[model samples]
Target chain A: MAISIVVTSGKGGVGKTTTTANLGTGLALQEKKVCLIDMDIGLRNLDVVLGLENRIIYDIIDVIEGRAKLHQALIKDKRFDDKLYLLPAAQHADKTAINGEQVKAIIDELRSDFDYILIDCPAGIESGFQNAIAGADEAIVVATPEISAVRDADRVIGLLEKAEMAPPKLVINRIRSKMMQDGEVLDIDEITTHLAIELLGIVVDDDTVIRSSNQGEPVILDPKNQAAQGYRNIVRRILGETVPLMTIHEEKKSFFAKLFGKKK
Target chain B: MSTKNVKLKGTKEGYTIVLHDVASFEEILIDLEELLLNISKQNNASTEISVHVDTENRLLSDEQLAKVYQLVEQHSTMKIGKVQTNVLTKEAATLWKESENVATLVTTVRNGQVVTMPGDVMLLGSIHQGGTLKAAGNIYLFGELKGIVHAGYLGDEDKVVFAKFNHDAQVRIGEQVQIIEGKGKNEPLEDTTFAYVNDLHILSFDQLDQIRAIKPKLGNQTGGLL
Candidate 1:
């Protein structure tokens, strides 16, 4: 059976869609059959992020409302060679159009066909979020190093725990090494300790991520990018492979300084 | 003949009707009615005496208290000032005990989470920003408090909150609120600070030493040092 994972963030604009798109692509790159479902109805952007906006003839709402078959609604990515597929959200439909049971039925139908199914959840703790998480067996909470994002992530984690899904993993994204080292923003250790969840991986704040998304290309298509490496590590971890957390800063300290440890 | 179970005594304040704890309900009612009837006949009808009903070591149900009040009103012009009972019902006693003891909280109060206590709270976990910790009495924190802490939530103004000061937090005691924004965010101003409602009904922060003088009964519930 395919392991369905829901990517959610309580606050808006914290890279939930980007994480979902990249992770879905990364899994496909490993020769796994991956299907991405955009659950953000009425405000759909996952198809645009995946550069498959023009190829979408039918959306998830069409399948749920019996207007289209499930296979007809799924769009294939030309680059993945029958590996990655996306079920786009209906832009015209509101979140209330589809309920949790419908989403679960769709996920259950797709379970036997795919190796991994990733659902891109919308921001906020509303009905859309509940519907997205309802069909998910596991959860990934995306958060930035900013206080507002971390606070919202904390709230989401609390809700996810109450939902009784497998202990949700945390992905601290858009991290700036300089800001963290300067103590301007919350550090990786602080964010993980405060959220108190299993740390999946950390993504650096790469300008190329936004640029690539604007061109309808996920940054994970490139291997050299630091942010791409973060996504790759997260995918490997999800695939049950052990990967050490990548160093965000390459600052080398003196031997004695390392032995005594720097004061926090 | 003088009444056996019920006695009427006049103190400096007013008349007090002392109901015997061991007296049978029927006998007490008959004696009390006889005593009140005699008083009503002797006193002028224009005078209305309000007497205190003291049920020493006797617990009366709501129905029994109402019956006592009804008997007084029917027999004479004497009004019951109030019913005084030395004992309490199980429910009332449980509620009182809950409010009298300190509650221990040992979990992280996350953002958007609110933890409320019936009495004083001794918290051993952190409170994140956007989280709230409220108590009907005082709040004693042994963990990081980065959120809003409200003491005397039920509006008894004398309660206080004691914790290490987090500048980003808002302190509320009773109806008074003091936002600690003037200080730098994430800065710990004092190792030990307390938020209290002062004499002017304003929320104020002070050092730990002043708490003893401010709330003398705090932490010394037994009235003696163990």
Candidate 2:
């Protein structure tokens, strides 16, 4: 059976969509058949992130409402050909247009053909969030290493527990090790302590992530990029293979590092 | 000035029916009964219905109360379940205070091991497989309890524990405990069970089971198994 994973964070702008795109691409590069489903509805962005914006003809809402077939709505990633696919969300509809039952039906149809189904959940704990998690076998909560993000992540974890979804794995995204060492920013341990969930992988604050997103290419596609390596490590971890965490300090220091004379 | 006024309003809790300047209490009761019967027949639902009667600022007698209960019960799809009186008592005033801190405890065990703190003990998360839990007080499980649970293990015998999903796990309340191993699989449909100490040993019954077998040999003298 294929594993359906929901990438969710209660707070907005915490890199849930980025994590979904990178993780799905990372798994596909490993020769695993992966499908990335964007359930954000009206504010869909996975298609743009994956650089397949214009190629989208039908979206998830169309498939759920029987306006289009499952195969017709699924956009095949040209890079991975048949291995990677994108089930984009509808742009005109609200979150309530689809429900949990419809999402489960789509997942059931996709399970036999794919190895992994990654759902990019919307920001809030509303209809979109429920629909994304309804058919998931496991969940990954992505949060930036900030007080507000961590607090919202904690609330999301509590909601997942109340919904009877098992304990979700935590991914601390966008960490700056130098700020953490200087005690100016929250560390991985601090976020994990408050969230109280299993630690997955942490992505360092890398400019390459933004640069790659602009080019519609995930960081994971770049073998030499440290942030890409972090995404790859997460994929390996999801495959049940134990991989050592990426060393954030090993990267070349920025001009600020030399000016401050600080070792990260 | 001789026009009759019948008012009906829906409140947060339920509906209220008001009759003004009726000929008598009997006439109002007959009109109310007909209204309830019409609503029941139109909705095609079997939900129980209740009515509050206030007549000329006079306290309703036992006979009047019986008449109201009987009128609602006469409808096929509706019956009077509760009747709240307007009169307040000292005991009722104290009951609000008494019920404030009433806590229901739940204990869950799975795979014959105590994975979590019993309902008597406040702990976090679900009890996993191969875990056991014991509580001196009440126990409550938010998830499935598939293991053994000993509530009121200290022999207090009055503690009660409830489980949301109970699946053949051994349960003990106090000194008097009955081992019900033959509660066949697939028996519990709703998957909830309650156990309390009766005559010392733990006694358990499925909510649907009408006839609970109480063995005389099982008494409070037997200590609860951990």
Model 1 chain A worst lDDT window (10 residues): A255-264
Question: Per-residue error at A176 for model 2, in Å?
Answer: 1.0
| The candidate that achieves the highest TM-score relative to the unseen native structure | 1
Report the C-alpha lDDT of model 2 over B1-226, residue by residue, as the tens digit.
1113334446666665555543577676767767766666677765556544444333456898787667666664444444444454567555543332234334222222343332245334445334567665556656655455666676657666566554545566766655545454457556455565545343755442321443233234243231
Q: What do the candidate models score in CA lDDT, each in turn?
A: 0.90, 0.74
Best-matching candidate per DockQ: 1
Candidate 1 per-residue C-alpha lDDT over B1-226 given as tens digits, one digit per residue, 9 for 90 to 100: 2378898989898989999988987788888899988887888676788899988988877888888898999988889997887888888877887788788988778788888889888899878788899999999988777789999999988998889886568889889998877566555457698888888888888888988888787766773212
Chain B of candidate 1 achieves a TM-score of 0.83
Query: For candidate 2, lDDT tens digit of each residue in A92-146?
Result: 9999999999899999999999999999999988878999899898899999989
lDDT of 2 at A259: 92
TM-score of every candidate: 0.78, 0.56
